[model samples]
Target: MAVEILIVDDDPLIRQTLHQQLVALGYSPHVAEDRRSAEQQLARQEFALVILDLALPDTSGLALLKHWQEAGTSLPTIMISGTATIPDAVEALKLGAADFLVKPVDMFLLEATLKRVLAAQALRSENTRLKQLTRGGRVDFLGDSPCIRELLAQAERVAATEQTVLVEGETGTGKQVLARWIHARSGRADEPLLAVNCAAITETLFESELFGHEKGAFTGAGERKPGKLELVGRGTLFLDEVGELPLLCQAKLLTAVEDRVFERVGGTRQMRFEGRIIAATNRILSQEIGKGGFRRDLYYRLSAFAMRLPALREHADDIPLYIGQALERCRRQYGRTFEPPDDNTLRQLKANSWPGNVRELYHHVERIALLTDGPRIPRSLWLSFPTEPESEPTDIPTGDLRTAMTGFKRKYIQRVLARCGGNQTEAARQLGIERTHLNHLLAEYDGRR
Candidate 1:
């Protein structure tokens, strides 16, 4: 996800130029001409980082930063000044300014500073959340679907023990939610919940990641670093997407799981940890074992206490409940009270299959809330499904399945395309797909013509 940045400056040229630069750097930049507009944006929602000019037409940027600190908004702010002095820089730093940059700032330096500040802020938030997780509080596991409820029950039971657990489910099935729930209920509830996406780490960095590395251990090992397992201490180490872990790393992981000890890359000393292991994956482990992608022994160790989350399709009955929940959440987040769907709209909602699951539902709800003029969302929201001509037959009937299916898909696609002003890119964006994917589907339909 791109970071959201708010740039506060009175100069229109500076704001426009920086906005363009920030957008090109994969950030959503919102410009505020003065302190008032900046405060409004800050009050509305949090930004990943803020770039504040030292002088605004209405107020000094230092006062604005202090105001933010007083108002309890902890957004990291970078102070940019054309007439900066040592005392001014010290004062700004004392007021929680992340970094001070002189005006006519080197673009490279500005980008590097923003990246570092944003990364530090993210790490701080992560660490704080981890500390809170270790305080033995109950995690509010969302969703009341039967599948989720059953998973919760299983989790509650498994969390009372120290055995390694393997959670299996498709992506966006809230695997991390279940992992956090387990941590909250476990005996190690008052310890850190260190989560690592095994798939994201490369084979070469696997040892350094799973175990702490000493200074001079390897190139770029400028300082000693503690791995997730060590940072987790006596808490929980969650290995998300464990199925994608490299084959060579799997052997080392299995040994670490068995002995609770590991050596960092280029380090001879062994470090021991007693943290609980919770691994999650979207792939079927048995199938992967047959394909020689995953180790059977490691799978068995992790699956000592196993739970599988049912896909959204199997739990179609819960769609209405989830839709209602998502709408309410969107209303709270967006600060707009949208009326619940009417009877006909609710019926359409129940009929549709949410392939992207809860995550998709949330996005759709947010989009509808923002796009709809009035409070009530109509059946149009439900009519936004992609043109799946071949798949429409199952919903219709036999006899003239091909004709019926094609007619339905074409009508739906054309309606949405028209609503989006014939712009395929915008239509695809509204439908949550790439324009190329939409073109391919349209071509497929054209072939049937």
Candidate 2:
């Protein structure tokens, strides 16, 4: 499609000249004579580029730009002036104007500026799309639920700012994923992202880990080593399981994160770092504060932009999609063909109240695939707490453990076929077996649910 250009100028000659130049370049051009006409055109049409004159008889172009910004109009506008001033150009740029062009505008220069601005907009759009699609490029996010969708949108908005995000979630709910997503979309994405698992570090090593240690500072210290704070300069530092931080370390960390400066362990020399701090916890921070487990002041600072990830049980509907993706990942890791759970197995998987959430479900699938024989994994591979009674054993003479195993497998095959809505392909995938082996199993068992 041809690019759409809007020319907003009071002078008919200037407008006509710009229109001709745009048309020569194969652009669809629209002309507006006055402020009212321009406003009307903007309301009715969508333009990729707007050539806006600074001085209008009825209203100033700068004023129009400000109005457009206030009204949430995102069209890229290039400001044109017959008498351009440094202040005017600065002000135009501050008001979200794309470019400032001095009058007697050269056609080539104008086209070049327009192309550059359009390319920038296109890049931004593409980045947004990729961020939205790739699990929001989240560190550990593993679900495709509506709750996660809304959380990603929130993350996008928060990332544009330098707010200290505090992610709160239950244990194993992937708080680190939310923190990484926030850092990934932030302005400091190019900078390093350093993480400190507070729960993993002891109180004795907390200070050294957070603040660099000078030579001979501790028993094992040989050379100077930078801490997480110093190492993450002009980037982001993630503190996971912050509730485990000791009081003294908490105070020091709070000061460093707030002031953007810190002193190394056993050293008095100060160091500065321009970066963002994102903290996460599995416990209720407010309750922790009341219980004297966390610092109130620090909590307020970290909670500037709070986000929570939904538990897997809350978004069980997304399990099938997650299973499919997880299975693909497993297949890649194990060098096996992808086989999704059959409908019956999927139903059973979804019905379970996943107390361990996504992490647990992943391990379960990986383990079951390893234990099951052939390509198809029958429902028997998974531990099912069925309420139905166990059938009495048939006493057949000359029966061995291998025969008993075959008979058990036959019954399990029948049960799975009964649950898979009669789709052989789905049944095979669910059993984690090859389609051919699944067909043989089904033939041996027949359709006896």
Candidate 3:
């Protein structure tokens, strides 16, 4: 689909210039001469990008930007003005403009900026779509263990309400998945479910990430941006690793959790967060509060309804079922079939401590599927599966399989490529995969590295 861009400017010359340039660049362009017309266009159509003149005759472009911000519009925008000052540019950005341009907008610079912004928006949209696709088929709770049943019951009880929920579990125990299950059952299931990894984002970026920022809020904040909270709208915002949020952020978040209100980083206009907040943390927050690392009040606010996910060890009986499910998923994912693990293999899997819980088990299953050439996974591969050290049998590896696999694959592929003297074709041949597949893997590896 061609990207559609909305040009909101009173000047006919500027509109014509931008429309021609957008057409040259293979985008569909629509024009609105004033704020009223712009509003009508926005209401009637979905635009991938908006070019607004700050000096609209009917109303200030900044006002329109503010309206979109408050209304939770996700449209990316570029602000243009013939009489724009630094403050005007900054204010426009603070209102969620994607870019700001002075009048006599240099065609080259405008095209470049539009491309950059559009590319970023496309990437974000793709990521969200992939996440939803991966999540779409696997909404059921996998195990029938007692603890699993109780967790589902508790989730059902909470899904009917709008109260805040805190999910606690060991790392890789599927806390986020369970949270999604709750959201899927909630009244807001039809809306977006956005997850933010509080631990992955640094403290300095946390505020802008969660509450959003105005243009000029910081040194590199070129345009106004909506935070995750705003993007979630009336859906669910999953705060994964909520405990890792700094104390300062925690204090600010408390208000949103309690009242669902927050202002952008550089603006005073209070915005309403109509979405549900679901926070998950691997840490025992009570201990963090006692250690002065967390706020007791915030903890209280989040824990109005809490659900604890049991570790895989706590439900050993479910291991076989999980193995079967993992095998089926692998078969579908890789387009290959495999015999289920035999009795002896199941016994070893159950006996071994699954510190990484279900996640670890699934990866092991994938690895087995990748390595096996016959109907059954060789029992010898069992020895290659990672296990906890003898001294720390209960301690599992930290982090998700994606991170682990990325690191492992990057290193392994690099070594192979290096051995092949950086010859991609040779490396692919040795790796027993198509050259295009190798190139894709190499691109992903380099991106992560």
Candidate 4:
């Protein structure tokens, strides 16, 4: 990607010379003879830097600068003039011109100034990115559900091997927690566990984040920085929400996943990926592949040993355990404590479906703890907490049991589908029904829409 440089000057000779100079310096330069052409160019394209002759045929360069200022536009510009006075240079600088050069512009100085301004821009961009990106917190398992016990057993078996692992489930089902569990149990537990949030990263930053970049790879790249893949030596690279990875990155990652090797951005040197990859996603990749959103080859390569974490509702018996843990955490974090709920309160808590799984439960408990003044939280709060809505549709009559039963089944299936975020596969698994059966029922209910 060549850096675009816009040259606004009336001198054909100077424009041609500067164009050749910019090209020789590995830039793409566009020329405009006057202010009209310059404004047109600015409207049509994005330029990294603008070179403006102080004495344009139509207007003074300062007037163009004022136009930029009044239009609420701030373009990085370098002002050039054959007869540049000290006052003219000061005015250009005040108008946000990055630099002022006397005519017969020094190409070396131009290159150096370009690097300086671009480097400053990159630093500012990186600082802003760093502020936007936040590392997620980790929460380990703390439940006695048989579903979790089975998942643990499976994780242990997979942890013994060096094969890549993929964990799948609904949101808040402890996918990352399971990834951590696998990492801790694996042979490379001593090495650091590095992670990257696939969904949070912008596409431009994706490659540099995973495979690093050589110093001076791009205009503002500066010093070389090692990415997660390089940092997680012989350890685990936990790619969270990997289904959201951009197509370009998916192709880039295939080399690392399949060949166990990668190259830094703009560098020919190849590096071996000695670490294991444990990617987790809440998405159904099969559906994404059918929709052409995910690559089938990448999916196959990643799912060498795939596992699904059970939704919290599947293990309702563990609700008490989680509730108690949430209260204790609230105590530790905010110095708020509460009595253990009575059996009826426990029953109500268990009755509601926790659609967001353990994460939602913790937040719900914390909210109640923060607002309630007394040790005993009001039971009304528990009652108000959402439960699976009543599924009986009014159209069904009370006199006909067979027809009424059919309506109940349809409505119940619809409720469960909503709980599973409308994934027929997950909804079927949740309802303890075959996918074909769910599809068949959905076909009949489609007319009700």
Candidate 5:
């Protein structure tokens, strides 16, 4: 997200001009008519900067700035006024305003001042770094679908323990989010949560990345560095796509996890890890184990507790909630507000297949919100699935039963997926097979293709 600024002023012209100016400069600018609206915006969202006018309908802007300072709120603020004396500027500065500008604020001056203030804030504290990662604050699952509610219930119970968890689902199903959900409710909520992408790291670097490597440990090792397990302290270590980890690294990881102790690469000293482990994967490890790609024992250890995040199509009833959440985020991050979808519009949203899950749905909502200029979204601006042609049954081929059945199954699955708008889960449900089994069959078909 870009830098989001809140412009608080009572003058309609000043608000409109500033909003346009900020947008022209590639900044996200939200507007508030008075102190009351300003407070509401601040409470609901985190802003990078505030451009406040001296006069507000309900209260003087100086008082609000002073209140923020005294309340220990950390926000870089600029105070602007048309009828201000030099004394007002000094008072505004004393009230902890980043800069004071006389109204008819110069565009160059405002831009330069904003840049200077933000640059200084970045170097001032570690909190600035944390703000980007957790600007949303505590995350709450927005959907009330049965699958979501059930997942929340299970997460609440699992979060009470220190068990190793393995989260499984399709891509963009919010596996890492579920990890955060658990860690936030766990005993280690105060500690940091760190993640490692098992699929991204090379086989040679995997061990050293999981466990700290000593100085001169390998060819590129110039100095000792701590790994995620060490840096996480008593927090949670999230291993994303854990099933893709190299077999050699998995064996080393199993021992370290089982014993709760690890040796730094090329070092004799043993280090014990006290942090909890949470692994997530889009792949089904049981299927991977059968294919000799993932370790069975490691899978067992990680699966001490396992859960799957439901695909968006499975929880289609929650489409409205997800769309609303996306629009709310757009309002916060892009200063864009969208009207609620009408009953028929929402029904279309619920019925459409979301093949890419929640992430994809969020992006689609954002796109529509950005494009819609009217107060209400256009009913015609809805997603449409590509319809598959009706597949007719064919006479039995002269091939053997095994070959005939294989070809039939492949074509049948493909047709079903097409009918479901490329939704694998729905296709699997229709075929009365596990989603993982369907995935394997698809993988086989793709390999042959």
Candidate 6:
């Protein structure tokens, strides 16, 4: 189908010129003389792009842009003005205009800008679709364990409503995946679902990142930016590791959650937040609140429907099913068939505690698939289970048990560190150890080396 373009301009000559150019370029062009007519056209038909003139008879074009933006309209727009200024251009872009142009617009340049804006919008739409497909394409909860069944039941019940949810689980326990499952099953599944990790964001930039900032709001604030809250209009915003949000941000976020209204930093205009919030945290928020690190009020507001994800150890019986799913994903990801783990290898995997939960299992399976020479993974390639300090290696002298254990610990830590690209925090999380403890071990190994 030919792309549809909406031209909103007061001057008949400019509108006619744009219409002719668009038609010549094989686009379906619609003209509106004022904001009222443009709005009526918008309501009546869907346009791929809107060419707006800043000076309209009924209202300023910027006012119309703001109206559309606040209404969560995703239509790509290009703003034009005869008496254009830098501030006007900045404001237009801030209001979500795709591009800005001055009047006496060259026909060629106008067509080029329209094409670029529409193409960019198409790319964004495609990217969003791909993300949704990737997230929603995973297998079902692959366990018949009672805990898993109960969790699925609860998720179904929660998916029927728009209530805020707080998902609590240890790291690598598939909390975000569960959130995605709930979102996909919900009525708002057709809308966008964005995830942000609070723990990953720096405290200094948290406010601007979440609530956005106006141009000139700070030294580096070159353009007005919309935050995640604004972009998640009528969708779902998954805040991972919500406990890590700074106290100052927690207060503001609580207000937004309760009142559904917030203003961009350094801007006085209030914006509405029309999204459901699903927050997750590995830490016990109640403990964090008691320690004065998190707010109790915010905790209460977010935990209206709390869901706790069971650790992998809690459902050991489901390991076989999980392994099967992991192997399937690995096969598709690597474009190679992999035979499942042998009986001994499976026993070894099930015997060890999976501190990193399903994530660890998935990575382990991928590693085995990649490293094994043949289709089936053998027990010899498996990582050795950690032994007690006094346990002796078969080939080691009795007095050298501690030395052998130290060597084993160092090698294990190094392997995990390498897997995490030397990120100590991530390595520590995967190893189920404290970051400080990981640091101490690294220091000891370095000193010994």
Winner of 2 and 3 under lDDT: 3
- For 202-298, candidate 1 gives per-residue lDDT tens digits of 9998888888677799889975666777677688999999999988989989999988898766678888988999999999998899889999999
lDDT of each: 0.83, 0.80, 0.86, 0.85, 0.85, 0.86
What TM-score fits each model? 0.57, 0.54, 0.62, 0.56, 0.58, 0.61
Instruction: Quote the positional error of residue 60 for candidate 4 in Å.
Output: 67
Question: Candidate 3: where are CA atoms >4 Å away?
Answer: 1-138, 387-449
Query: Which ranges of candidate 2 are over 4 A from the true structure?
Result: 1-142, 383-449
What TM-score does prediction 1 earn? 0.57
- How much is 249 displaced in model 5, in angstroms? 1.8
Off by over 4 Å in 1: 1-129, 133-138, 386-449
Residues 1-449 of candidate 6: C-alpha lDDT, one tens digit per residue: 88888999999999899899888988999999998899899989899999999999989989989998899998998999989899999999999999999888888898778767875686577547745753556435567789999999999999899999999998888898888888888877777788888988987788788888887999999756778887676778999999998898899889999999999889999999988999999999988987799999999999999999999988877888888888888788778777776777777677779888888877777777777655666666565433447766575433487888988888889999988989999999999999999999999999998
lDDT of 4 by residue, 1-449 (tens): 99998999999999999999999989999999999999899999999889999999899999999889888886788899999899999999999888899889888998888877765665445434432332233326777888888888888899999989999999998888788878777786666677789999988999899998888998899766767787676778899999999898898889789999889888999999898999999999988998899999999999999998888878888988888888888788877678667889888778778889889888888888887865888887755665567898557557588877877888889889888888999999998989998898899878766
Q: Higher lDDT: candidate 2 or 5?
A: 5
Among residues 3 or more apart in sequence or in different chains, the pairs in candidate 3 whose N, CA or C atoms overlap within 3 Å are 93-215, 94-214, 94-215
**For model 1, which pairs clash?**
134-190
lDDT of 4 at 269: 93
TM-score of 4: 0.56
Ranking by TM-score: 3, 6, 5, 1, 4, 2
Candidate 2 least-lDDT 10 residues: 129-138
What is the descending lDDT order?
A: 3, 6, 5, 4, 1, 2
Clashes of each: 1, 10, 3, 0, 0, 0
Q: Which candidate has the top score in lDDT?
A: 3
Q: How far is 178's C-alpha from truth in model 5 (Å)?
A: 1.0
The sequence of per-residue lDDT tens digits that candidate 3 reaches over residues 356-426 is: 98999888888878887746778888547765566854434358987766777777788899889899999
Counting only residues 3 or more apart in sequence or on different chains, how many pairs clash (N, Cα, C under 3 Å) in candidate 5? 0
